[model samples]
Each structure stands twice: as C-alpha cells, then as structure tokens.
Target chain A: MPPTAALSIRDLKFRYPPGADDAPAESGEGVGGWIVDIPAFDLARGEQALLTAGSGAGKSTLLSLIAGLLDPDPSHGAGTIEVAGTNLLALHGAARDLFRGRSIGMIFQTFNLLHGFSALENVMAALMFSAIPPREHRARALALLERLGIARPNADPDRLSVGQQQRVAVARAVACGPALVLADEPTASLDPENSANAMDLIQSVCRESGAALLCVSHDPSMAERFTRRVGLRELSAAPAAVGG
Target chain B: MAMTDFQIVVRSLTARRFSTVTTIITVAVAVALMLTLLGMKDAARRAFDRGSGNMHLVVSRDASPLVAILNSVFYANPPRAPLSYAQFRQLRDELPVEWAIPTQQGDSFRGLPVTATEPEFFTRLRPDPDREWRFAVGRVFRADFEVVVGAGAARQTGLRVGDQIYVTHGTGTVAALAESAGARVGEGAAIAHIHKEFPFTIVGILEPTGGPHDRVLFVNLHSSWIMHAHDRRLASDPSVKTTGAADVTDADRLITAVLLRLLTRPGQDVTAVEPVVFDQLRRAGGFTVAKPAQEIQRLFAIVGGIHQIFVGMAGVVLLSSGIAIMLALHNSMEQRRRQIAVLRVLGASRGRVFGLMVTESAVIGLLGALAGVGVAVVGQQVVASIMRGQLGLVIEPTVVPAILLGVVAATVALAAVAGLVPGVMAYRTSVLRSLKPLG
Candidate 1:
C-alpha cells in the first residue's frame, strides 16, 4: 500500500517461433527457444530504473512486449503484465492500442519521430490517441517543446540536430502524460555529452510528470545515473540473453 | 490541434508530390478521353435527330432509306438523280401527304451547299419540333432570283441581305474550280464555274437552327431551273449570248427530293401512320420513301458497334489508369513501411491505416475527375468547331451533370478499389520489425 506499482510483471515467458529470424537474435537465445523468461518484475510509481544488457540481449524485445507492440509467446507459458493497475494482456486490438498509447510512452535510440511532421506535430500525435481534448493539444505540445528548450517547435524533426531530435522524441513519449515511460537504448546514437543531456532531460521530465521510467541500454556507464539498476542476465531466466 | 485523418492523408500525398501528381494526371487524361467520346457521340446523335426536323418522309432516288435521309435531310452529298416535274406532281396528288415540298440540290455558293425549293419550304418545314424557322434579317425569297442565306453561311461568306452572290454549278470551292478550269473571271478571279449571268441577291438570313440547315443557301426552284436551262443552251451552242427564264420549259424542270409530311388523323401521332405511308410508297416503287426518324435510328444502329469499340478503348484507358494508381501506391508502400509502422505505434489501428490509404487514392481520383470534367468542357468546344467546319453538322454542347457526377463517383470508387491492395500491405505492416533502423 505504500507505493502502487506502475508496471508489474510475473511469470512472463516469450519464445520466438521456429525459423522466425526476422530480427537478429542475441547469444543464440531465440535458437535455444526462450528469448524471455522472467519470474517477477515491478517498478513503483515515479521510480526510475536502468536495465543494462549487452548488444542483442532482447532489451528492445522486452520493451516492445511491455508496450504491447509484441505479445508474449503464450504457447510456452501464460503471463501477467499489469500497467497502471490494468492487465495489458486482456485488451485486444484497438483497446490494447489505446491502453498502450495512454498508459505508456516509449523512446527509441533512433529517435523515431514521424517524418514529414514538425517537432510540435510529433508530440501532438501522441496526444491524438489520448483522452486530452483536441482543442488543447497544440498549446500542450508547444509548452512541452518549449520546456525541453526547443526554440522552434515548427521545425521539422529531420532538420534538428541529433541532440535536439532526441529531445523531440522525449517530448513525444511524455506528451500523453503516461504513467510509465520506456526507453530502448535512448542515447545509443548520441555523443557522450549529448547522451548525458538526453538522459537528464528524459529523467527530469519523468520526475516532473510523476511517471516511472525503465531505460534499457547496452552501455554499462548508464547505471551510474540511476538509483535502481537491474542486469538482463539476472532479470531473464533464459539460459542466454534474448539475442546477445 | 491534432490533425484529422484527412489532413494526415493529404500530408502523406504532398510528401510524395511527384508520384501523386503523375497519378492524378494519368487519371485525368483517361477521364477526359472517355467523357469527350461520350459527349461527342451524344451531340452527333442529337444533330442527326435535329436534321431530320419535322419531316415524316423524304422521297428521293437514292439507293437506300438511310442514304435518302443523308442526302435529302443532311445534305451529306448532292443528289445524283433527279425526279421529273411530272413525278413530283403525281406524288403530290396521289400520296396521302399534308405538304409536299420539292427541293433541288447540286448547286453551291463558296463551298456551301445551295438548296432551291418553293417558298412553302421555309414556312412548312421546322428545324425542330415546336421551333419555326425565323429570319435573322430581310424576308424569305419571294422573287425569282432572290436568295436566303443560312446563319452559318452568312457568317462564313460575309453575305448579308441585299448582297449579290453568283451561285456555282458544283460543290467545289471557288479556288478548286478555278484551279481545275484555269478560267479567271470577276475582280478577284472569284468566278469559277459560276453562272455569272444569273447573280442572285441575298434577300434574307435565317437564324441558327443548330442543324445541318444552318450551312445552306436557299434559292427559289424557278431560279435553279432557269439557270440550268441557260447552261444547257450555252452547252448546245457556245455562241448563245443570252438566255432567260422563258427558255425553261416543263420538260427541263427537275427536283432532287421531296420532303413530305403525311396527313395524320386528329390527335394521332405522326409516327402512328408513318409505317403505313412508308409501306404504301415502297410498294408503288420508282422512288425511295424514307422515314427520317427510322433512318436515323438505323444509322445509329450501324455506327453503334464503332461507338462501343471506342467506349471499350476508353474503358481500357481508365482501367490502365486505375492500375497506374495501384502501382504508384504499391511502390510507395515499399518505402513507407517504417512510416506505417510508426503510425501503428502511435495508436492508429490497422483499419485506420487501411482507410487512410484508400482515402488517399480516392482523393486523387476525385481531384483528377474534377480536372477531367474541366478539360472535357474545353475539349468539347474544339471538337464541336472541327465537326462544324468539316462536316457542317452542328454539335450542341451536351455535358449532362448527372452523367458527369456518375463518372466522377465511379472513378473515385475505382480508385478506392485500386487502393485495396496497397492498403492491405500497410495493414499487415509489423510494428516491431519496422521500428528497427534500416541499414
């Protein structure tokens, strides 16, 4: 009762279908049949955790699973993934999409900002699926971009510098004011200084919004900034890492 | 504010402006071609129908009924054979006809066909039902050498009321006749095979009737007879210096065709007794009795195959454009997988993605079809001008709004159907795989 868990995972198991080599596997985990086998995991509300893993360690795959982009392989085992006190696995189709969009925000290393959209528009796109009134979307998006030190919210994301683009992506992720935020190697493409700045911006934004943060990275140095740290090898019961 | 689905579709199309515009133009060209063919065909049929006028039957010595109507009603060609004055009298007396007007052709003024008939021809004949022939200037020819010019003829030749014009013997242009005859007469060498001795004064100009009649010059039958008799006299003895109307006798009087309106019972449709009169005239023999309406229908039936072939060709073009739309969108899908995946990741359902693709295609088609309608309208004027100049057949601008709307709606539906393949490609896009950065 002290603190509600923003994201709770229990007895989660996922395996790639045989010959499903669409994505590169790390450490021969997909070939060995169990990419993810976690017994239990939880992040308290407003908590920030850094999950470190080597390359191809299924870090992105785990992020995808929590975001409802990919489903856990139920053939191996049934699992429960609860986000904001709602069972994410129970939702289907558009309901699942709405739940993910409203309750979770994700940032990628590549800064997956929608092309052909301005920085403000990328953030507004997140709010499009939220419960927020459409009339207030523009002002909210502009305020968020300004808060992130984006001088020109109308500028195309592609025209922005690498550091600025990441900040824009960070804005998009938290635009909906989701309860939980996920980062899959969010600073992998940045220089050391830019990476530190991106991490600081993301963490500060999450703290301001009272949102929990789970950032996955192969870089060992990322653990120094987080009060909570978990290793992929310790979290996943797979014989090897998901891919690396 | 969040952009609507329509706004998103528009933005996506604008991002690939080259392909979108190319596809729209391809669709526009196909729609224009199809609508133009349809419009011209409808106009031609109406012109033919209007040319028939109120005539129940056209009796001529042509080979067939359709030929008789074309030569007598449309002036498609000058009549080769002439019916004697005695035969015209006999037909007027014996046939169950209300008004029998005899018309003689084979004369021309400045390349326009010249038709000579009685004054009753102007008063009794109508260019269209419920529309009487109205004079634009002066009055109908009442004297022997007086003439009435049609609206189109007056405009083309610049002949006005009281202007004198020498009528030529054949349908050839003055230049062509001069080139053939090597004879130069008149101030500008304008006299070529023209019966210069008998200069007819234009006494009247008729308003446009929107039919082949608009391009004709009308003269009295007595004037034509007198001119021909003088030609015969001059041919017999090249020294014959003068000839007058007194030289024309009953033996020399001839007319090419007789336009007949049958005597119908009170309140009875002219078509009701048309077949009976047609059968009776055919049985008597010696003359071609053609119902102008029936002949027009037959002409349409004969040309219907060619019309269908053109329509089929246009449909093929439309189908090819649809395929172009499909290929254009499908090819773009290959490069747009990541974008589609991103949309899905942003909470756009698969159905939403599918709908977006189809809506984009339909928008392109709607725009293209609207543009095509505009092109067809301008194209119709050019086509109508050509037909008027070359065939002397006036084509009314016949762009029916219902037909246009139907074509536009069909094109949009066709484009939507074309988009289905690409929409499916987008719907099946994997968010997880596509989110990975491409090498």
Candidate 2:
C-alpha cells in the first residue's frame, strides 16, 4: 500500500563465467560458485544510499546491472531487478534501454562528457531521449546547467576545469528528471577540495529533482554524506565479495 | 540548443576536418571526371550528327567511306584523289539526285578550312533537320573572290564583314605556311607563293549552327579555280598577270567531293533512295561513295570502345572513393567506441546509431556529388574550348539535369552502402566494455 520503491532487488545472483574477461580472480565457492549473491536490497523513492567497497569489489558491476547495460544470465542467476516497480529483467534490450534512459540517471567516475559537445550540448544529449518536447529541450538544459553553477554553457567540456566538468556530468545525469540517479565514483578524479564540492553538488541536485541516489565509491568519507550506507561485503551475503 | 542526428554527424566530421575534407575531395574529383567524359561523348555525337547535315551521300576519292565522310563533310583533311568537274557533272546527270553540290577544300584561311562551293551550299543544306543556315551579319557571297565566314571562324580569326584576307594554298596557319616556304612570317615576298595572288573579301558571317561547319570559310568554286590557275602561271612566268574568274578552264576545275541529295518519291524520306544511288556509284569505278549519317555512326562505334575504357577508369576511381569513405569511417570506429557507448547510454538504440553512421556517409556523398556537378560544369567548358581551338569541332557542352541527378543519387547510395560495415561495428559495440575506464 505504501509508495513503490524506486529500486528493489530480491534473491539476485550473478557471476561471470570462468576465464571471462571481467571474471573475478577469486570466485566464491558458496551458493554454487556465485560471485554476487544478495538476499534483498531496496531504495525507497527519494532515498539516498552510499555503497562502499574495496578496489576490486563489484560496486560498478551492480550499477551496470541496475542500468541494464549488462544482463544477469537467468540460468546462472535468479531474481528480480525492479526500477520504479517495473521489473527490469522482464524488458528486452531496446525496452530496457528506453526505461534506463527515462527512469535512471548515471554519472561515471571520469566525467565522461562527449568531447566535441559544448557544456550545454552534453546536458541536452540526455534530454534528446526523454519524453520532453524538443522545443523545451534547449531551455531545460540551459536552466539545469545555469542552476548547477556552470558559468559558460557554450564552452567545450574538454576546456573546462575538473570541477566544472563534474558539474556538466551532473547536469547531464539529471537532465531527464529520472526517478533514481546512479553515481559511480563520480568524484574519484577530483582533488580533496573539488571532491567534496562535487559530492555536495551531486547530492543537492538529486534531492532538488526529488530522485533517489545510489552512489558507489571506495572513499570512506563519502559515507557521512548519505542517509544510508551499505558495504558490498555485507550486501553480497556470500563468504567472498565479487571483485571486478 | 538540442542537436539533431545530422548536426551530430556534421560536427563529428568537422572534428576530424582533414580526413573528411580529403574524402570529399576524392569523391568530387572522381564524379567530375565521370561527368566530364559523359558530357564530351554526348557533345561529340551531337557535333557529328549536325555536321553530317541532311545530305544523303558524299561522293569523293577518299580511300574508305569513313575517310570520305570525314574529309568531305567534316573537312578533317584534304582529299587525296581529286574528283574532276567532268566526273561530278556526269554523276549529277546519271544518278537519281535532286541536287549535286561540288565542294573544294584544298585551301585554308588562317587555319580555318576554306570550302569552295556554289551558293546553293548555304541555301539548300540544313545543318540539322529543323534548322536552316541563317546569316548572322551579312548576305551570302554573290561573286567570285567574295567569302562568307562561319561564326566560329569569325570569332577565332577576328574577321568581320568587308575584311579582305588572303587564302592560303594549304590547311596551315600563316606562320606554319611561311615556315614551310623557307621564310620568316614577316617576309612577304618569300611567302607569296603559298598564298593566292588575289584576296577574298568576307561579305557575311553565318550564325552558329552548333556543328563543324561553324569553323569554315565559304568561297565560290570559280574563286578557287582562278586562284590555282594564277598560282600555276606565276610559277612558270613570274611576270604573268593574275588570273580572273573568266580564266578558269576545264583543266583548273577540280573539286575534292560532291555532296548529293537523292531524288525521292513524294512524301518519302531521302533514305529510301540513298541505297539505290549508293550502289550505282559504287558499281561505277570513278567515284568513292559514302553514306554520311551511316559513316558518322560507324565512327562513333569505333570510338565507343575508347569511351567505355575511360568510363571504366572513372568508375574505378569512384569505387576507390567509396572505399575511402568506408575506410575513413571504419578506422575512426576504434576511437569512437566510447562515444558510441555514451550515446547508447543516452538512450540511442543500436538501429539509431547504425542509421546515424550511414547517414553520415550519405551526407558526405551528397555534398561531394553537388560539388562534383559544379566541377563538371567548369571542366566541360574547358574541354569544349580546347576541342574548338585544336580540332575546329564546335561542341555544345551541356549538363543534362537528369544525368546530374542520377549521378548524385548513385553516389549517395554508393556511399551509404559503403557505411554499412562501420555501422555494424557501431551497432555491435559493447556498452559496458567501452564505458569501462582505460588502464
């Protein structure tokens, strides 16, 4: 009867095949050789969580599964990954892509803004796939960039400072007004001062947009800023956590 | 502002400006060369068709029918065997001919072929079936030593109505004739033997007929006979006076060829009687007979092989350009994998990404094809000018819009086909692998 969770996972399990390019070096023998074994996880609407893990821990892989960039082999793993109460595992490739573009926003570790695009265009790129009217895309992107403290919306992303580039990435991530936003080491490339600023900026923007946040990072300091914190080892439920 | 897929493609190309521009130029040069060859071939066919006129057959003393048609109709060279006036008269009286016009072409005026014929040559013959020869400035020549210049001849020689110019004994420029005479160009007396004693006054200039005749100078047959007679007398007796038209005798009356228009039944085409008259002339031993229209077709048939070779070479160039487009896009795929992944994350489907790549190639082709049309137009004019100056063949260089459209469409389609390989590479890109951080 309560509002549906933005993200829900139940009895989910995933493991790369042995000798696969991205297979973990030390596979867990527990639960039939599974790499990632989680009993249950959920993020309520408008909730914020920081997922902390070691360097090889599968924090980014979890984000990839949630974003539908990779599929969990149904034969090897079983469970449901639901976004906004819609089962992501039930959707096909293109349908999943559309759902991800409309319902989820993702921020990468390296501030991967398209090189040739200006600050404004990078933000607008996300809006291109949204249900927003084409006539309003420009105005909405500009408003988001301006609100994010981007002084030169027309400047190339490559020429912007590290902090400014992170801001552009943040603007691009939330441009579609998604239900949940995923941040994968979004401040890893910034120095201490800039990292704090970038973290604050990402959380503030997500909260303003009324979206839940699921951020992955190895930094212990990021834990103080989130309302909820879960370590990858505890979430995996298996004896050994899956290393990427 | 929001960018469309096309705008993104354009920006991507501009980002790698050097490769894009080079690829477009390669395509443009190939397209232009192909279009130019097509234009020249079409122009050459039209020129030959128009030059053949409405005449049914040509009677000359050339070695073959093609040579006879070329020497007699196109003035390509002087005839090797002279058809005497007596033989021409005999044929005129013996064959089923409506009109027999004797033509002499042993001389030239400043490199323009000088054709000596009766006044009927202008009034009777049509350069094309529906077009009549009309004077651009003045009337046709009325007397011996009076001449009518063709439009191209006047333009090239700067000859005007009422200008008197000496006719040379051979088809060479004045400097070449003087050199052959063992004299410098300015040595008037030393070069005198190469020119007629009397000068011909240009009385009219014919309008452009879009044929080889546009580069000729027309004179009366009597004028040629008198000039030759005077030259012969000067060689024997240097003090002999210049001969006039009245001095032209049977011995001096020699013609290179005779253009024949066969007599046909009422409402019948001239081709109906052409074979019959052609056979009679062939059976007779004195004359060489040629069907002008048939010989022109034969000439093109022999030349068509060379044209196909040129077209094949242009096609190879065009194919290479297509490969260049493919290679350019394919080589960039390695660097663009991450960009493709980013677009995929931004919600672009595999089909959309593939289409964008193909559209990029098509856009490049469209641009290059349009630019090639421009280049072809300029190239055609340059080729036409050279043919006119060197061969005295008036080629009407025209760009057929249908051909242009077909070439452009084909080029774009070729380029789009070329893009399929790179498009597949993009479609199959692994979003997660590409988005992973590089070590």
Candidate 3:
C-alpha cells in the first residue's frame, strides 16, 4: 500500500453471511482468513487501473464494494463507508444516496440509463443529485456532456449509438465532479472506433477531475491501457467450474 | 421530487382525472340524497312542532282527524250536529273553560247572513291572544240582528258600521225576504226584511289572527232563531196568512252546535251542565276526542321514518362509492409502484407517502360535502315553492345539527376508508422494488 494513493485497501474483508463458515473468497490466503480479503491495492489520483477477470472472478463484486453499494462489515454495515474524507456507506439512507451523488460516480457494465430520460437529462439528473445549488445544475451538466463528446445533448439515450450512450454515461459519471469514478466495462458494447472515442473521453475526464479511475474488463486491449492492471483471480478463490 | 404534499396530491389527482372525478361524483350522490331527505324531514318537523297544540283543535269525530280539525276549528266546513243553545250554556257553566265560544258555520250570505252564535264568538273566541276585540271603525255589535266583521270580511264585502246589512233566511242566499207573511215578522218594514237578509251594521273589523275567524262575520245566536223560526213552526207557518210569532217562538227549542272548553271534569261540576265539551270531557254524543300531539306525533313518525330510511340508503350508496374509489387506487398501484419506489429513493419517507394519499381523499370528501349541502338547500327551495302553490302548507325549512353532522361525517368517513387501501400499499413498498427496473 502506497501512502500517496488516493484510496488504499489493506486486508479489506467481507462475506455474504450465515452460509459462509470460512471466507467464501479466501484462497488459503493471508493472516486471519476471510472472504473478499483485499490483501493490497492502491489507486493513486489521476490514474486508471483496469481489472481483468473471466466470468465469476468477482469483477462486479469488487466494483460494487468500491461503489459502496455493498458493505465491508456486518455490524458497521449501516454506517458510512469513507473514501478520501467522504463516507458513501454511512451517510444514512437518503444522505448515502446524496453522498454517492456528490462524491462517487458509477457506470454499469450493462450501460443502465433510465429509459425515459434523454441523454442530457440522464446526465443532468446526476448533477441534480449532488449538493450543488439547483440553479447551477443544468449549465454544469450540458457542459460536462459536450466535453465528454456526447454530440447530441437532447437525443434520447436509445437514439444515440452505443458509443453515444457510453459517452452519456461518462458525462453522468463526471457531472457531479466526483473524486472517485468507477466504470465497469465502460466501452464493452462499442465498435472499435466508438470504443476508442469512448475510452479517450473517459480517460481525459478522470484526469481532469484528478479522480482515481478503476475500470474492470477482461479485454486485452482495454486492460493494457490502464496505468496498473490487476487480475481478479489474484484476489478471489479459483473460479468454479461449471457442472461441478 | 422537491414538491410539497399538496402540490404532489394535486398533480397526482389531475393525472388521474377520470378516476378522481368519478370518486367525487360518487360521494356527491351519496351525500346529496342524505342531505335532501334530512332537509325535508327537518322542514316537516318544524311545521308539526310549530303548528301542534302547542295549540290544539277540539273536534267531534265527523270523519278523519284531518277533516274534524280542519272543519270545526277553521270554521270552513259545516258542523256535524246541532247541540241546542240551552245545552251549550249548561255545559259552559260546568266545564273549566278558559273561554268557550260557540260557532255556527255553514251558513254564508251572498250579501246577507244569519249567524246562530253567542256574542262571545266575536268577543272571546277570536283566536288572537293579544289585542282583545275592538272595533276598527265603529262600536261592537249590541243587538241580535247586529254583526261584527273580520278585517278581511270587511275589506272584501265593503260593509261599514251603520250600513244596515239586511238579514237573510238560513238558506244561503241573497234574495229579498218574500216569505215575510210566514212565521217570522220584520222589526221595521220591507227594508228590515231582506228575508233573513235583514239590514245590519258592521260594528267591528277584527285584526288578523291567521285563523279561520279572520274571514268570518259574527252575530248573536238569537238572530239565527228569528230567521229560521219558519222551519220550526211549519205546521202553522206553511199558510203565511195565519202565521204569527207565537207559533215560531214556542215551537223552536234547538240551535246549532255548541263550541265548548271544559271548566271542570264531568263528576266535579255543579248545577245543570253544558251539553258539549270540545276538548277533554265527552261531547254531546260521547264522540272520540283526540289530543293533537298524539295525532300529530303519529304523522311525524311516519314522515320521519321515511326520511331516515332515505338517509340510511344514502349511507349504503356512499359505502359502495368508497369501495369504488378504493378499487381505483388499488388498480393503479401496479403502475404506481415504480413511481413510488422512485420517490422513496429520492427521499420520501413512508409516513409522508401515506399522508399524501390520505390527504387527497380528504380533499375529495370536503368538496363532496360542501356540494351536498348546496344541493340540499336548492332542493328545499324547490319543494317549498310547490307547497306554497298547491298545498297551503307553510313549512319552514330547518337545518338540524344532527343532519349536518351526519352528512359531513359520512363524506369524511367514506374518503378515509377509501384512502386506507392505497396507504398500506405505499407503506409496504421497499427500496429494492423501487430501484429495480420494471418488468
């Protein structure tokens, strides 16, 4: 663990509960065996780290934990989970949502955008969730979308190509000016050219916000683009073989 | 998302305008029926309450309760039987009469008249409690042939004091006296004999009593005797040339029916007694006498029962309407589940959501209740207009507290009941259900 890292995880442990007598994630691993033990990892500011994992390699689980959607400890599960000085897990029910809104941004591997909202609206909603004064939200959101190369600000996310949807997702992720941005397979659905465009937009925005970017994917081309890459198998137990 | 409760409810209601309007109309019909019947009942109650005995009519059971009271007391219908003048006097002495003035009705004059009643009919029996008899234009009647006029009678007939209104035969006519040579003799000459249509003065004009006496002309019972004395001595009076007052006076002993108020109970009074008692004691024929309250109470009971039944039926109708509203809300919930979940994620508390739906129903109830009251008032006016024209019933419309409370309570209760289904649905919704995409 580096002292200069924006986020440092040391022996960060978790399990689903009652069913797991021993840590489900332990690979006969470190001191005090536990599931989901992150022996070590560091994401310095302004750096993008790609996670490479095959199916069932805990890529999504890691993304969820980092996003604060899941808890790290059973007893203190309801309390805020801190990143930098802000706590996403402990912000009380509604305020946790608000803190996530203001401090952390997420892009799903599925590219989940509210179906009813336009690309601009999808992005604008993210900014509105932040503690920023409402009057400043629209202007800030439009500027963020355009900067992310979302050419059509008023188009519905569906009307846009996959590339455009990815850009809109990126626009939403950075619209709040978050300190941490988590993108799970951010350009997985895009063609090679649009994927390049999407990747360029995400990388530049993370650098500008000085937000530590943790992007997960098993694609060779995408994983090598990150400042540091990690394999999920290096952390979790061996992937279960089907028909076991 | 930041909207106040009222604003949200208004938006939601407007969004489902058809459903909301249906709910309100349902409540309106239910409440309107209850309000209208209750209003009519209130009016009828006031009429019975104000018109009952409170003041009573003491009558002989000629036919119906309505008939007997109307005829005897209004003096508009003919008396059933004649109780002799002597008999009337005897009973008046016996009964604990506040005032017992006899009436002789059923004999009208086209212009000339004969009233076979005591002078007290004009003096004491005119129903007004205040303003005892005083002549508006002239002195009160003094002689048997003299007369006193009610205010309306004087106005319509145009006969003033000293205007000799000739007496007429009791045959209800206006022809000059042609049977003059019979048993009866005129005091003066042809001028005095207008049959029983003799000349008499209008000695008094009675102030209005809002009673039958208001249109009557009053005269002493003796005047009727002199006019009808021909009928009494028919054996001799049929041949006018031989007829005389001796035959008329000696043969006639009876007069018209007596109007009596009891002075004392039958077992208690002294001397020879009066033959008729209008109120309590048995009359000339031991007729069935009814206390006005008992008769009136029964009438009110029938009317009020019908009224209560209508209101109760209205309550059932309202209950159905409430169920309709509850179903509408329940049906909409499947669609609304996601929206509510969104609101939960966006920070609406469980209590707030519950309160919001309840408040919407309350608004509907308030509006329906107000509309029902307005409808009731208009309905009352319509009934009153009809009654005034056709029935001569002056029913005062009343707003009884119980009726108002019942209508208002029904509206609110129905709405509150309607809200319950939706409130529970909203309360049980979860964050996972809301945050997840719809199927």
- State the displacement of the C-alpha of residue B361, model 2, in Å, after optimal TM-score superposition: 1.5
- Candidate 3, what DockQ? 0.06
Q: What is the TM-score of chain A in candidate 2?
A: 0.91
**For each candidate, what TM-score against the reference?**
0.92, 0.93, 0.52
Q: Tell how far residue A126 is off in model 3, in angstroms.
A: 12
Q: By TM-score, is 1 or 3 better?
A: 1
lDDT for each residue of candidate 2 in B1-439, tens digit (9 for 90 to 100): 4668887788778877888899999899989998999888998898888887778889998999999988888888879788889998998898888888999987776667889999989888877766899999999889988999999999988999989888776665554565356443544222323453587898999999888888999999988899888866776798987687676778889999999888877666555777777788888877789988888899999999999999999989998999999999999987788888888888888888899899989988888888898899999999999988777678889878787888899899999999999999989987777877611
Candidate 2: residue B16 lDDT (0-100):
78
Candidate 2's C-alpha lDDT? 0.83
How does model 3 score by TM-score? 0.52
Give the worst 10-residue stretch by lDDT in candidate 3 chain B.
B185-194
**Residues B1-439, model 3: lDDT tens digits:** 3224565667567767888787777777777767767777767555444432222335454565555554554443455555555555665676656555555654454432334567665555435333355557765567766787766567667877776665444322212333343333333221222343344566666654433454567776556565557444543466643233454463254444444444444444221233333433543454434444455567677767776777788778878777777787788777666656544433355676677777777777777777767776777778865553333234556657787887788678778778887888877765333433211
Compare candidates 2 and 3 on TM-score and give the better one.
2
lDDT over C-alpha atoms for residue B133 of model 2: 95
TM-score of structure candidate 2: 0.93
lDDT-wise, the better of 2 and 3 is 2
